[model samples]
Target: MLEQVANGKLTKWLAPSMRVGWSMVETVLLTAAAVGIGLWLRPEDPMTLDADFRWILLVPLVIAMRYGGLVGVWAMLCLIGCWYVLKTSGLYAQQSFPEGAMLGGLVFTLVAGEFSDLWRVRLMRADSAASYSLERLKNLTQRFVLLRLSHDRLEENLLTKPYTVRDALFRLRSLALEESSDTALPAGDDLLGILAEYCQLQRAALYPCRDGVIDDRPVAVLGENRPLEKDNSLLAYAMENQLLAHVQQEKEESYHGAYLVAAPISNSAGKIIGVLVVERMPFLSVNFENLQLLSVLLNFYADVVYAGKDTHLLLERWSALPFQMARELVALGRLREEGKVETSLTLFVADDSEQAGLILDALARGLRSLDLAWWVSDRTLLIMMPMTGVSGLEGYVLRTEQWLQDEFAFMSLRQAGVRFFYRHMDTRSTEVQLAELLEAGGV
Candidate 1:
């Protein structure tokens, strides 16, 4: 079996390389042999056989056609020299060297061979362009097919019940956020039940976490008569790698023969908090998409734990949310109008990357405690200052630009060159104007 596998790989490797080399070799050798035979067939005496053997030139013509003009020129020189030697020795025919025929053959070889080479080059370029276009078309088609399948799945799931991927995620987020008011996660058993139903698993178990290590005892068990062992390698492997594991059942005697999947639940800090073991029900094949969705939901549960059950502080630091920014903007506008405080909002739209993040970090450190910033898009950030005006905004922007230039020499944050866009909101503006500015992203 090993030898067969090795031979198969060797054949695959040789197939493409051998094709061009073998064809060139075969054409060169075949044409040379034909030329030799033609010379031998010529009569010894000039009386019986014709001295003009124009048919012999066919060998060089073919070489010029298959190879190129340069190769044809070289072959012509060799053939002409051989013909001269044969004729002078009276081996070919009783005649002197045919200089006119030789010259004609040389011209023919050069012209025909170069023309063929030029045509072949053009053909190859055209083929390469076509292959590139075909590959792009295939990629587009595959994306379209995947999108169609996703849409169909969404519709089918929604028609069957109100619970869909969106609802499952929203419920998970709500549960995570609820940690602020409570110490122990409320309804841990119910949450496990929700997960089991969402993933359509027949039997499952959930473990509680203490000080980063998952408790061996099951905190919640669903649709199972007896609890499974927590020390299994399948669960241990998933927790160690921080990934979902699907144990393939090889036979009834195998270790994971009864279970289908083992997954870990981790917090934002990547500390394993729980393990979810599930059994595959008949006729229901688990898929990658479902596994990913389950993993995200579990991670959110972990995030809740990491937040120390405090929803407010978690929400404040994670200001990349539009609604959060909008709420703060409304409060700032009201405070400005009431003559209680002076505040400004700056909209920064820069390319999304690690470098842009550095700019954000610098701003975060330099700004006051009341200042706020959030990513409105993958490439845009909105910053709100509780007590800053237009002049203060100008200084902040310039300082940040200087910092960016100093840190990354290749990148200059000049007004014209940089993709970053920023504008300070007018605190004197009316509520309607504030709303308009927020809606239009300061235009």
Candidate 2:
């Protein structure tokens, strides 16, 4: 499956070169065919200028429509070359060139090319936005599943387990921050221990993956487990789909696998950095709820593993802020630096603390799944929006204003004693910008 993915990527990488080559070939052949037809009709004027309509201009127009302006210009040059060929070969021809006709054709081709280019860019941007949205949706779906499962389990095991899932995650974050080892999976044994307690895995192993390839050796193992197999079906399925796969998922296919469950551990950017394979677990524990918890826990651990050193420093500086928010802020900043996407941070502040608190509660209730909100103080609130640009921020602000008017009967934000400030993530250091924003909001 990995090999197939790699091949598909390679094909996509070479598609542009193949497209250009094919376009060149088509331009040459079509130009030749058009010249042949023109010569058959009027050998004296192969360009067919003697006719009321210039039929030869269609070649460049077609090429322009198909391959854009550059290739269309190439087709026009080929026509010029054909004309010169006729003139030099002593075929009957006019003394002067048809400059007006050629100029008109060039202008028409360029106009068509410009339209194509414009639509191409629009389509590319739309596709990129869709892909980012899809990834966000997938992440949110996993979180929702985990939430539902956690709630159900809490009802059953509230007395048995002293700490909630959130507490376990906080401990995981602490482990990530404090680990000094250079291995890819920091506090591997502790992570597995948490999973064992939560997922009821009697025997499992966590194997580190580098560059999409899983290592044969296990970084962390619980109880007695077989060594990692090179051709494990569950591992292949999990890596292929970037999700959790278990024996019950496809009984006919996965029943033959040596492990009961396999899951990929992916970072916030959705890159798999590790794999967890369970060799032994109770039959009742192989259900969807338990598997979902396992996947979520692995993903949570992966996020902590991927958080850079900058995130740790930010956490140390602002102990009140959540680790997840700090990690996302740094990730968005890196994305902005790479010119892949933009993020926005909005601060809502009010002179009246009571009004601000009310507004903050309302905003909290209306927050999107992808947004992270922090109640910075009694008089201030901060929201971080991922993959949002200036235009998106404007729309968000407008919507919030309308909601305020409808919910609180306030004429405007100013009337409600509220003011908003926004900043788009830029090339500056994320930690520095965050500190500045927080200080400006008087946090």
- Give the distance in Å from residue 97's predicted Cα in candidate 2 to where it truly belongs: 99
Model 2 residue pairs with clashes = none
TM-score of each: 0.39, 0.41
| Model 2 alpha-carbon drift over 4 Å, by segment | 1-164, 176-182, 251-254, 308-324, 328-443
Which candidate tops lDDT? 2
Q: Residue 260 CA error for candidate 2 (Å)?
A: 0.6
Global local distance difference test of model 1: 0.59
Taking every candidate in turn, the Cα RMSD to the unseen true structure, in Å, is: 15.7, 19.2
